[model samples]
Target: MTVFILVGGVFTGADVWRETAARLAAAGREAHAVPLTAIDAGRPAVGHVDLETHIADVTAAIDAVGEGPGREIVLVGHDYGIHPALGAADRRPQRVDRVVYLDCGMPRDGVPPLAAVPDPALRARLAARAGRGETQGELAPPATHEEWQRWGSTAGVGVAALDRLTALAAPQPLGTLLQPLRLSEAVAAVPATGVLCTRNGVGIDLVQRLVDFGDPVAAALAGPRVTFFELPTGHWPMLSCPAELADVLLRAAAGAGHRLRPADTGTPPAHLRPFPLDVPEVPRDRKGHVDLYVPGEGGARPAVVFVHGGPVPAAARPTPRDWPTLVGYARLAAAEGVVGATLDHRLHDVADYERAAADVTAAVELVRADPRVDADRIALWFFSGGGLLAAPWLAEPPAWLRCLAASYPVLEPPPGWGLGDSRFRPVRAVAHAGALPVVLLRAGREAPGIAATVEAFVAAAKDSGARLELVDVPHGHHGFETLDPAEETGPPLRHAMRAVVTRLTG
Candidate 1:
């Protein structure tokens, strides 16, 4: 028989797991919910409760269960709860047979939950309160239903359940989030299961894609001992789908979830696969920081500078310039009687957008300076995460800049990304776009979080009355240029390119 221990997130108590525990007990399984030092008992002694207090609470739960032969224990952690669960498991590695990371990012050692707080305003306020010598500091729970979504997707949670969740909410200890989780090498041997919640923006497919993209952390998760399961609901599976969640927890304890394969870096990832286009290949000028594809028959032609998206890992092979999508777009532009350019920008991390923007500016200058390029007739095209780089160009379009285009762009940073800068928010910046032509290609099947950003940008653009031309690829994914087949993605891809070209020359 497997015993399960559940740890709830900030602002939650053991009471939050009542339904799930009952379901588990009905299935003849033992279940325990750890009430953290400050969270379950209401908002008293706020600063007195740090991460160690909660870790101790979990350790005590483990002790009560006790370790013996033929006994198995599964520790489940959700959101902020994962920290203490990991800390306790690190201390009692022999007791915990498996650790379930429920609907949360993989927390790393020495990184506090404060670092991953999704809301910018809340994160800033928390930082201010914690940075001060406020011994009584605590974060109040969301008072409204809409505010609850800031923590995670609340889909499938009914009005009554949400009201109960809000009414029972307790202020979280500031210290709990401030302190980091410490782990030892011994815990690495414990098998792990990840329960992904699709509505909260993370799913198994995205994880596998990240692994395929050469992310070291994602690679580590692809190890044999790590398995995955996906719930088609929101973040709080306990409240939204308790029975299903209980069933998943049981299967996870038995190590019956989906296993991920290691990324084969040798083969190009799906996003980097040959762009779904059959354009004639044009010779690329590989000598400069920008790869330029000059038209075969024209001189001083309009140029379109294609900016590839990513906080792509610094270690990712074959760089953006070599990606088939960018290469294909540039060659296709050259084939259409225009100069096309692509560059390798250093957007190697979530926090490097400013630096990436600088790289883009320099690349555009390099492209405009080329002898065969008509500097006054140039368009800037951005893709993927590179979409944020379009902010400055959108906010204040230059006389020489003719048009701006983005394909499946991330117009706004998702809350979890911790991007607090206002300069990178295109949704906010598009209001200042004036009459500059804007072409946006949206992916219908984009990741939920990213799709939200796109929709917000479109709404903002429409409200501002910007010269926006929108194209929807009803069946396309995020990197649709390479992810979807040509028949599905080609029309929009060429149409967006043509729009930019028309703005440049017409």
Candidate 2:
């Protein structure tokens, strides 16, 4: 695999990617540090570059790599480099295998980089400079070590590296910052990953803030194709954590050939093993523990929290940590390139809905804190009796939650299940179901009592304008996967699983 590195704005030359490129080369991969034409160290970029010019520069680099059948290229873009890299990918989708956005803004069709700038004054100034026919303008960097520390660059980069960056900094083309990025839907099809710099405080929340502020680039970042990895460093990972960054790039490249969408048919990938982490959120009891399934891959992946059915006899109820069906689901999720977690919440008899909700909350926090998991792209999967406890999440879901799935769920409060707690009623929770999409899987031959409740809950959710997708299993019954894993039930169960996976990943 050939990895193409694009440096950020206001920085000239490919020197910034030297450490990262050397690391990739050591791993037996070819790395190309492609320099932007007008933004180079050889001369002043006073009147020579724009968005189109940089796009052309990247396009030339892609051409030089010699694209053909079975030839794979991974585009790595840092900060402002994202614009040109995406534009090049849009122009050459078949040639580019994957695109990685490193602590940068992801561009959408017709949205300029200036539009996504958080500060209105800076945005207006850049726009005005472009309008005034200024070919280039200096993007001032921190002049002093104290200012550099305040900017979060000194945390990861040493004095020498910081000095090198300062020496290599160049003036950026005003027109390039102002030019609207023209991308096609084909760019969306390319597998994409975002390397978030957490130590610099840049993560999913920052992306969401941009989305909430109506930035198109931020909106695109929220899409399904973009998986995320968190690096515990400042913005300049190339200078500070090159080996780690190279490993992340390698993992991304390895998975680039797989289809972004979950397979509709076929046995899952072979290596479905998970690295388990047992977290005791409540007490020493097994019911208070949560098991996180980290994929064998090296980079961060999205997460799914599995909540199992319960409130039965202790011997009859399977332990959440060792349940075969849940473990199989987690393995399946890992095979599909996502982190999976099975959590144990308090049984209904031991506590009310509030306590169960608290357990789920704790599980979510645990998942978010894992370095191998993307805190933003999390989904909650509730099965059978556990759905009621997850009702609060559906009622007022967090912004980071992508979507949720419930299979053969007990949405309505049964007579003894809730212990007379009114808050356990999932039917009432529908009214507060925010815009988060929900997948409801209903077994066709379910018990009449359970079927009636599911129907009532579905009706209420529809009336409340909740986004819902219902998958009906025509020949299966409740807990079909556990009770009967034969041909009769396997197809429908897999179908429901695929649907939920698609919704969650997307």
Candidate 3:
């Protein structure tokens, strides 16, 4: 027999798990939903309730359930609930078989939930409230559906559920979000499951990409015991799809979710797949920082600079210039009678974008100085995460810069990236690109958050009357050149590439 323990997120109580709990019970599993100190409806919340207080609540639930022979426990936590759940699990690893992270980021040591609050205005307001000692040192729940969106997407939730959620919402103690969650080495021994909510912006494919990019945090998730599952609904799956959530929890407990394979394990990773078009490789000139592939041994011709997207791990082998996609594109451009250049930038993390931009600028200068390249005619093409690097060039176009192009580019940084006020926002910077020709290749099946940024950039481009040419790959995914090799992707990719090459040479 397996006993399941559920912990709710901020402003929520055990009652939110009612429907899901019933389903679990019907399936012959015992489920207990822990009502933490601040949000318990049976009693008034004390002003000083904190994360430790919630951890105690969960530990108490575990004790009452009583671990014994033939009886195991699966600890499940949703959003902010993951903090206390992790703390309690760390304290009683012997009693926990698995810890399910439900629609939330993996909690880090010494970092509070408040630090990652998605809404800037709300985060500032909460800090101000705490500073002023208001609301009895508590943070109130969102009052309306619109307000709730700041927390997470409400794609699959209903009006009735939303109303009930608001009515049952309690004020969360400020300390719960402010206090850092402490864990021990014991928690790492227990296997883990990640339940991602796709509509809210995260999905298994995106997680896989992050792991492939050599992100340390994401890499940690590729451990053998950590598995993943993605739900099509939004943040609050317990409310939106309780039955499905219950099923997933049951499946997770049985260790039946998808396992992630690290990039090294793949013979050649997805991004390293063979290029769609067969073009002979042109010998690369690696004299400077930028790798240059000149067309013919003749007069200087126009150039196209290709930027590979990443906050890619600095340690990943076979640098960007050697990637099959990048190398193939460069070869293709050279075969088409133009110079193609690729450079490895230092976008090792989100915070390093500024440094990466400097590397790119320096590489451009080096590429321009090459006698084989026509310095006055150049087009810059960016991909994926490198999309943000285009902002400065877009905001203030140079005389030698003829055009800009991006494939499945992230136009704006997502929340919690600490780039809210960054100048790297192409959605905002596109407005400043008065006469600059911009080519955008959009992936229809892109991750929701990234797709939203692309849409915003498109809207901004329209509003500004920017010289933008859009190519839509309706059935493609991000890294479509390698991920989706269907004929549909071929046409749009070539069209976008041609659009840039023509602008550079014409």
Candidate 4:
């Protein structure tokens, strides 16, 4: 059988599935990782490559790989790649023998990919980002390590393998996320399997939850023709647990008639459970709420407060407490035996940088007052816009503040955004950073202006005797935390988060 592997969304190329392909090839199966037109080496795709374009790309790959008369094509799709995989199967059911949906959305006719996202807020956020003119409808990756890991589990992969995948990820075109898959009912006839990396069945439960909430794709996975197989890993099993994923794929391809196994029904780890939401820090204020996630066996644990990116237009701002990525990271931190707190601060238009700083300060006080939290050990994590607001704290941080982490932070105003305002220049704080340790995580592929500002800050911090460490994500872009976190970027994100947690807890 000729196995055609299609990778997930974003700037990802076929290289994301290299391990799975090589393993299948070693097992004596014909395997090919098909690169989509948007990411193909020599194709050089231009503006707005839609679903049809992707379908054509996959169709051509299928035709090229299934050239032999006797060869049977097994189509495999990961994440957003499922749309094209199914589209190809619908277009050439006679040529395709099996279809595998690997921890991805299983799209049907008419519904676009973004419309199928279970969360309405997330769908809107994606659309809003696309509508922003200068961005040209391109979405960057998740901006932080915690957000990246929360997007997918990468516990099973080695550092080298994860890094290789991260290096290959690119900025995804918005059209691909918005395009509807043109699939036909005939696709049902092709043998299909839904390979879920549930990490001890949480994925299964989440799917069932979405189905209960009326998600059509989740509802379709519950269909009779689709066999569900669970793998105890994160979303990107091809990178996290490739050997086992390959085994399952090979078994399905060989027509072994495998069935869904009994999933682990034990209590999920603390981090995976639903954390307490909308706990008020400032009881009288409507927007002064915070979400807290605590580890199962916690006892006066250290805490890390997450400050989200923004200062965005009021009309487009989201309630930070409800953000899935932030909430997930809080839960993940709790799972790691740290108290994770995600807070909401005033927007730039509503309050100056000082007011935002005060909001974070109030949040820290609230956390410190909690009986379950270690009052003496606390850390602050800032992303993008939040980085500027954190300047005062970084300059003259409280004795109790253990560490500070900033990811792709806007330490200085963009050239056109009132650079004359010293209030917004976080670089000035470097001289006052003192002996307090700071972790600065930057994307190597960010805008030149942002890179230059960060470079200046790093140089200044070093000369000022501030104990600072810089972690570089070579292939990532600005706001990576909000983008699709692929296997390649997971390790660095995890590493950065762990370092912060260690410093604060120690």
The candidate that wins on TM-score is 1
Stronger candidate by TM-score (2 vs 3): 3
RMSD of each: 3.4, 20.2, 4.2, 13.9
> Which run of 10 residues does model 1 get worst, by summed lDDT?
413-422
Backbone clash pairs for candidate 3 read none
Residue 223, candidate 3: C-alpha displacement in angstroms: 3.8
Task: Give the count of colliding residue pairs in each prediction.
Answer: 1, 0, 0, 13
lDDT of 1 by residue, 142-259 (tens): 8999878778878789999999899988988788888877888877899999999876766787788678778887798889999999997887999999999999998898888988
Worst 10 residues of 4 by lDDT: 278-287
Of 2 and 3, the candidate ranking higher by lDDT: 3
TM-score of 3: 0.82
Candidate 2 wrong stretches, greater than 4 Å: 43-47, 117-120, 131-142, 146-154, 204-224, 256-506
Q: Report the lDDT tens digits of candidate 3 across residue range 1-506.
A: 88899999878899999999999999999999998886987756655787888989999888888657978899999989999999999999998999999998888878777765776657778677656755347677889877777677777899999998888989888888877788878898999999998777667987887787667778878899999999988889999999999999999999989988886785777877888777876998895668999877988888999998887878777778889889888887888789999999999866778899999999999888888889999999999989999999999999999999999998887543546677888998999999899999999888877888999999999999999999999988888888886587778877887888888878
Local accuracy by lDDT, each model: 0.86, 0.68, 0.86, 0.68
lDDT of 2 by residue, 372-435 (tens): 7888888888887677876778777888888788888878754322133346677888778778
